[model samples]
Target chain A: MQEKIKVTINKKPIEVEQGTTIYKAAKELNIHIPVLCYMNLKDMGIEHNPGGCRMCIVEVEGARNLPPSCVTKCTDGMEIRTNTPRVLNARKTVMELILSDHPFDCLICAKSGTCDLQKMAQDLGIREIPYQGEQSTYREDTSPAIIREIDKCINCRRCETMCNDIQTVGALSGIYRGFEAVVAPAFEQNLEHSPCTYCGQCVAVCPTGALTEVDQTNSVLGALADPRKTVVVQTAPAVRAALGEEFGMKAGTLVTGKMTSALRELGFDYVFDTDFAADLTIMEEGTELLDRLGKHLKGDKDVKLPILTSCCPGWVSFFEHHFPEMKDIPSTARSPQQMFGAIAKNYFAEKIKVKREDMVVVSVMPCVAKKYERSRKEFSVNGDPDVNYSITTRELAHLIKQANIDFHTLDDQDFDQPLGESTGASVIFGTTGGVIEAATRTAYELHTGKKLDKVDFKQLRGMEGIREATVDMDGTQVRIGIAHGLGHARQLLEDIKKGKSQFHAIEIMACPGGCIGGGGQPLHHGNSQILIDRQKALYKEDAGKAIRKSHENPFIQTLYKEYLGEPCGERSHELLHTHYFDRKKRWIKK
Target chain B: MSSVKVELHQKDVDKIKAIAKEHHNEPEELINVLHATQEFFGYLPAEVQEIVGEEMNVSAAKVFGVVTFYSFFTMTPMGRYPISICTGTACYVRGAETVLDEFKRQLNVEVGVTTEDGKFSINCLRCVGACGLAPVVMVGDKTYGRVSPDGVKDIIDEYKDAE
Candidate 1:
């Protein structure tokens, strides 16, 4: 067991584990110290405490100068004064210096209400910036999913840590020094030119307006207002699990009914669920998995055994850039978002007696990368995209507020028929290990020719970065692997590259905790417990459903019977399955 | 945003690979390897750093970061006759700012930039360990002590005439 040490903060004594940060010890005493450069995702095992901003400086007795509490370790009998006049003045001066270089455009900034630096300035009561000087400025970089307004960076290095340490994308790093210092790609290249996967993890961790999601809400509103256009909206499974937090609802609050009502209020002609498409995904992907498994079992030497899940656009981009050699190893099933768009524009539009061009299929996702994914040329035909617009969970919340809908009192409603109906298997796609588990449910039943007594695969579910489990499929021992976060996915891919992996199928979600902790979800503000709660809400939603298997979803059964014909058939491949490309040579700009 | 792009020669790529191999391609020895590359090539360019990144298994952005963090490394090529003006506190007090301004006026270039003609470039150093020679300017290896605004033209003319 770890040793515990006693420390005094503002005259109150507390016991904490040795090597604990002074900030943690002070929190035990109910003393809140404002911090800017410190971010701790304890559950994800990611902590960035650069102590660059000096906003969390506290006076340690017997020390010559105040030390940053976020990075400073506590010793036994250490008396720390967080609110001393000396510490207060120093913090105020440091904040003033930071503000002096920062743009005073919070009224127009995208991150005004949620910016950590703005809140820190308010907490410090900084009325004026006394240390005005030349401020650092850089040209704005607008990518498909994110915007880099680097002039507002406070050099907190939070985005750097997330990009390099957590995601391992390495598209961003701290460059230059002193006043010229900023986070950017090599040669200050634009993100599109860099190896950025457009995961939006950097935007998720940025403490200021330096990084943010590219706002597509205005275009969505324009489409909604168009009289000739029929704008149909689809909400991803993860959006409902966390959208309630944008209002005053608690973290785990399930707002599916209220969300559908709010979308209807926003003038969407029809409100559908991406979970419906997720069910279709399982039908197609599960069949593909079974075919590959059977072929490998028949000693097909050329067959790749462990077929990877390709539902995440960010993960797809990552593999395209980093592991192009294994491009053919993942399943060809299009993501649920794209699958929904294709079906809405083709099948659903035909049923509604509307031309595909006159119909606009918008998606509300808990992922920023979906914006980039929907914009891919492969997903478009003759310049008409399958999905017209992709907005994030945060953007949807903003649209609801802009529409003046009283979300709290909105009546519980249901999704539109056919395209809106989904099963419990589809609802679980919002969290890690969910897609593979959902696939296993159908695959097990289909492969063994027997019904599963319990649909839930508890062994495959957890918060670990990488998990492996063996399932008894009748008599065959089929191994499965689950990985979330691109860094963890890199390890599994490396194992596959070395030909040492022992799994028959693998699932990879680019974001930590899967879509529940997506880059476009409601900001947790450095509290990871919100992610756990969101995961719980998704599981609860799944448990309460009457139909628990994708094959068991009646609407899906009707659709496959009426339209798709059979899973992975020729028509299904045309509409649902897609191909991958080698993007390793794309980043070398001349 | 104006980004600087450089085309590397095959020899330069080979040299970078050699330097990386000297450091055994360890990511932790990135700084040392970068120093050796800068020492051989006079400055670190984007293409050179990209090769080093690939060889050392580090990111090009991180290699650029280390290059820009230290004062000794330069991204652009230095002019044949590089002019460095001391901007130390002692030198600034002794009218070094005026000397720097005069150099900027004559060269038609800002600090850390080369002239369009490629004959001269201007830079500012904190100190050259010659506090006694306050307000000093160095042209290549030769130091000019007590340089005034009037002498700036003479320094440029000396290099221009020599070429």
Candidate 2:
């Protein structure tokens, strides 16, 4: 159906699609070429090859000069020499020039071990820089979720591509030109003053120390060291799916048990799972969905049908800033992390006989936005936050290693009782299209008053950018929409705004592949297969779970029967659900 | 871009909306709207950029990026006397760096920043096609050619009492 081009690289011949770049063709031959300022998430349709850095250059036989292979397309019978002395010399020279401008402080740099630019220099065997001049510098901007050390930027524009093109948040861009050119928020304003959703996708793709997550490991360690405080830690489902990679394990090795053991060993008084709150989220949000459906079916036109899920903090802030007019359309359910916090600080704290201020609820999440979510004033009682510290999966790994715990040889252990209990439905919330499927499993049985023969909604699962499915609830066909990246979410919201949406409900997550590809997860380094593997791990976990439905989880049932009277009762409203704000009004303060 | 706060007037806001409307409020029309706003306000402050972003349906950060990318756009207000020095190859060969350093030393102000009294601001331009009068300096509309570092004191004294 498509044309193919035969290209010869390093005397090896290969045939690929007509538009395949030389970089991909070289990869086909297993000839690895070092790259900088080039990132390609082909699965999500994202490719940022600015060609600003000349590190991936190759010599074309017929061409006058070497061209960067990332952008140079493969043509018929094209001869490309990747490892020639000339090409190597040029690449090394470019890398040296980059290093000359960079600060020689890798030992203390935030991205020290994982920095791509550092790896590039090592791969090219660069020892010293012959060229030297004034290096560009700017004030470091420390936002709630991200840190921008502009001096380390290589003008890669990967963050720009992810922000403007993938997420459509448009919070960052290239601000200047030439030697002094830098990428920053508008007017170089701090991210707090910018229209940043604090999604942290920019931090995820950064090649240098220019962008990184706000390190909260020290605060978490401090809370653990505080003898007066009871530190209760909750690990998100997605964190288990990917945290293993930080310990030299495979991408999809589910480290749930080991992570729980590590948290306990690291001094957490209680090791809980956010999946419990995810199940709790289903209890409230599913009820709201059914209530809206019942009212809509009964001719109550005021009820907002097509209720959107409110589990993603990034998506919540995105809508708050971009689509505030439709704020009431989404369910008022707080994220699983916040729900765990509120319950830990209030319901669980009281059950354990610990005072609210004495119990510090820490969240082990696979997201950077969770940091910003924990900072929301409304999610606090008086001045004390619901979650005292939110650490990333990467940060948790650092702590486990810092404690000298041999993660590989350590025996797997189960989570604590009551608070750690979770169901299969909540486990699936780690991936895209998982939330709606989980909701469907619970909503269908409740609405139809029948048992589901199969729990897995195979029709509603995939890595597709935008997905649609229909579930027959008795005689009614309930339409469902699922989207992962915010750009796709924008399309669904735009359809709703135009009165053209046919779905009865929708689920949206800000990051790619849901929380598995979160900004705070172990960096995939442009390999999208890692994300796919992470998604599969979550589904694998869901399949192995004993209870596959949220409502059927006995602990959640007990939570409702004891502390929270009903699904959407007054207590649930106060502790589980929260409101949205029109952030456009507060975007930039005068 | 400067972080100083400036409250925009209703009429200036209306003018920005009109300029954006003239371009159908498209994201591509962002530069045109920014140019018109800077012309009206004499600078592109954060407040004016916010309004342009609102009218254009573009993010404010993106608008700031475009303003900073081009050397022509200024975020802070220009002083009563804006001084521009050419630093092109022709001028640099004729002691332009010395002239720039002399100005910085005399005014105790950084390039692109105004004096505390708002009387003078210094900037550098690449070329003005005045190689015949190499190392040229321009104060508002007046141009001084063949300028040396020794003449910097006299130039500052000329504008010292003009206010």
Candidate 3:
């Protein structure tokens, strides 16, 4: 056991493990040393303490000067004064200096209510900035999914930490020097020109409006208001888990019914669930998995082992940029969003006698990457995108509030028929490992031609960065690996590249806790418990469903029979599957 | 801050790849690889940095970040005779600012940038350890110490005629 370092915070006794920082020691004594740039999501294993923001300044007894509590180690018998007048004055001055260069346009800022810098200022009672200076300004970078309002950057380097360290995307970094320093892509190029995956984790962690999602709520409204267009909306499974938090509900509160009702109230003509498409995804993806496994077992050396899931657009972009040589390794199933869009525009539109061009398929996702994914040229036909627009869960919540809909008071409602029907497996798609687990549940029964007694595979469920499980599919062992964050996926992909991987199929989601902890989900504010809570809510939703498997979804069966032929068949491959491309030469800004 | 875009040909990419390869193509060897690439290309532009990043397995954005952070590295094309005027304490007291101003005026280029003809670039440095000479100006490998502001035109003319 590590020796506990005794410390006194505000004359209160506290003991912490050796190497514990002053912030952690003070936290034990219920002393909240205010911080702005310090974000530690213990559940997700992301701790970024750049110590650039001198907001958490605390005076140590006998020390030369005040030190930032985040990076300052607490020595044994150390006396830390967290709320001293001197420390308070220093903190105030530091915050004032930061605010002096920052714009005072919180009224119109997208992150006004949730901005950590603003909240910290209010907590410190910073009324007026006595210090004024020339502010650092830059042109706004508007990408398909994210916006880089660099003028608002406070140089916290949180987005830099997320982009480089957490996601390993390398899309952004701190450039220039001191006052001119701002996190941006190489050559100050727009994000679209960089190797950015558009995962939006940077936007999720940004304390200010420097990084934010491209708001498509206005576009969705325009589509709905247009009388010529028959607008259809699909909400991703994770949105139901986290959307309630936007309405002041608990972190993991499942608001599926209320969310469906609220979308209807917000004037959406047809409210569908992306889980239906997720079910279709499982059907298509599971078949591809089994097909690959069957070929591998038959000693087919040409087939790529450990077929990777293509549901995550961020992961797709990651591989397309980083590992283009292994492009053929991932399963070619279209993600639930694209699958929904393809079906909505082609099959559903034809059935309703609505022209494909006249119908607009909008998706309310728990991801900003879905915006980029929907815009992929292959997902569209004749220059018209299958999904006309994709709004985030936060955007939907904003739309609900903009329309004055009482989300809490709204009664529970069901999703529309045909496309709305989903299963337990589909609902679980919101969480990490849920896709492979869902695929396993269906693939097992489909391959063995027997019903699975125990539906839940507990081994495949957890918050670990990389998890692997081997299931006995009757006699044959089917190895499964699941990775949530892109960094962990890189590890697995690296192993596969070096021919060290033993898994048969892998599920990879770029965001931390899968879509429930998506970049576009209601901000967790570094509270990782929110991710766990959202994950739990999704599991609870899965447990309560009558149909536990995607293959068992009755609506899926009817669709396959009436319109689509078979899983991974000619029509399904054309609609539900897409090919990968070598994008190595694409983002090189030469 | 230089927004000049230059097309990197096959040979240029190969040159950067060779530099990165000599450094074992390791991510940790980014600084060393960049130093050599800058020395070879006369400057570290985004195109060259992108190639270095590709060869080094590091991100192009990070390469740019490192290049921008250090005064020694430059992304813009340096002049044929890149000029560095020392602005250290000893040099500053000896009128290094005036010397730098004269160079910029004669060259018609800002610091860290080349003139329109790309003949000269004006940059300011800390010190050259030549306090005995007080103010010092350097062009390529040649160092001119105790340089007055009026001597800047003579220095530019010498480099222009020789090149």
Candidate 4:
């Protein structure tokens, strides 16, 4: 065991483990030392305390000057004062200095209320800026998923850590120095020009308006306002698990019924569940996994083992940029969001006797990458997009508030029929290891032609970055691997590239906790416990369902019988499945 | 998804690969590899950085970040006669700003930018341990000490005649 140390903060002695940061020690004493750049999501092992922002500095006794408490380790009998007059003066001055260089457009800023800097300024009671200077400015960059407003960047480097250290995408880093320093792509290029995966993890970690999701709410509103448009909305499985946090409801409060009612009240002609499409994804993806497994078992040497799941658009972009050689290794199944869009336009539109152009399909997702995924040209037909637009969970919350809807007291309502019904397997898609578990549920029974004694794959579930399990498929051992963050996915991909992988199937989600911890989910503000709560809520929803298997869902069975004909059939291949591209060598000049 | 594609010759690419190999292709050797590559190529361009990233197993954005962080590195090529004015506190107090402004007026080039003719470029540097020289300017390796705003025209003329 490590040695223990005692530290005095505000004359209250507290014992902590050796090498404990002063900020953490103060927390034990319930002394809140406000921090800006310091973020600690201990559960995910992601801590970004650079001590660059001097906001968390405290007065250490006998020290020449105040030192940053977040990085400074505690020593025995060290006396620290966090709210001394000297410290407060220094902090206020530092805030003013930061504000001097920052744009004073808080009222009009996108992150006005939720901005950390704004909250810090208010908390410190900073009234005026005594130190005024020329504010730095840069051209705003708007990509399909995120917006880069460098002028609002405070140089905290949180996004830098998330982009390079966690996601391993390496699209953003600290460039230049001093007052001119800003996190940007190489050559100060636009994110679209860089190898950015559009994961939006950077946006999720950004404390200010420097990064934000591309607002498509206005266009969605425009579509709703159009008389010629029949706006149909699809809510992702992850959305319902966490959307309640925006309305002052507890995190992980399952608000599925209220969310559906709100969408219907928001003028959406039809409110469907993306979970329904998730069931369809399992049917198609599970069959593909079994087909590949069968081929490999028959000694088909050319067949790729460990068929990777292709549901995450961020993960797809990651491999397209970094591991283009393994592009063909991932299953060709489209994500549930895209599948729902394709079906809604081609199948559902025809069923309703409405032209595809007149049917506007909007998806409320827990991911920003879904916005980019829907924009891919392959998902379109003759200049018309399969999905009209993708809005984030935050955007949906804003829309609900804009419409003056009281979300908390609304009566629970069911989703519109035909495209609304889903199974327990689909609800679990919100959490890590869920897609593979759901796939295994169907593939195991299909492969062995035996009934599953218990549908739950207990071994295939957890929050680990990378997890492996071997299932006994009759007499065969079917190995399965699950990875949730892209960085973890990279390790698995590297092993596969080196022919070191032994698994037959793998599931990868770009976010840290599957879609529950997605980039476009309600801001958890680095509190990982919220993610755990969201994951628990999804499992609870799953357990409460009557049907636990995707193949057993009557609606999914009806979809196959009436329209798709069969899983991985010719029509399904055209709409539900898609191909991958080697984008490593493709560099477009602006 | 637009970017300016940077292309390099095969020989230069091979040289970069060799430098990376010399550093054992370790990601931690990124800065050292960049310095060596920059020493050979004069400046670290985007394409050269990309090649170094490929060799060193580091991201080009990260490499660019390190290259841009230190003021010693340059992305654009230096001119034939790179003019540097010391803008240290001592020099600035001694009217080095006026001298810098004169150079900009005469060369028609901003700091860190090369002239249209590619013969002259201007940049500001910290003190070169010549506090006695107060306001100093360097053309290539030749230092001109105690330079006044009036002497700015003479300095440019001297370099022009030499070229």
Candidate whose DockQ is highest: 3
- lDDT (C-alpha) at residue A249 in model 4: 91
Write down the worst ten-residue block by lDDT for model 4 chain A.
A581-590
Error of 1 at A341 (Å): 0.5
**Native contact share for candidate 1:** 0.55
Consecutive 10-residue window with the lowest summed lDDT within model 3 chain B = B1-10
Count of clashes, each model:
0, 2, 0, 0
Comparing candidate 3 with candidate 4, which one achieves the higher TM-score? 3
How do these models rank on lDDT, best leading?
Answer: 1, 4, 3, 2
- Model 4 clashing residue pairs (backbone): none
Cα lDDT of all candidates, in order? 0.91, 0.90, 0.91, 0.91
Which one is best on TM-score? 3
* Chain B TM-score list for all models: 0.88, 0.88, 0.92, 0.87
Off by over 4 Å in 1: A1-4, A585-590, B1-4, B9-11, B80-111, B115-163
Q: TM-score of candidate 2 restricted to chain B?
A: 0.88
The reply for model 4, stretches above 4 Å from the true place, is A585-590, B1-6, B81-110, B122-163
Off by over 4 Å in 3: A586-590, B1-4, B7-29, B149-153
Best-first order by TM-score:
3, 4, 1, 2
Alpha-carbon RMSD, each predicted model: 3.2, 3.6, 2.1, 3.0
Candidate 3 residue pairs in clash (backbone atoms < 3 Å): none
Compared with the true structure, what per-residue lDDT tens digits does model 2 show for residues A57-172? 99999899999999999999999999999998988888888888898999999898999999888888888889888988899999888889988888899999999899999889
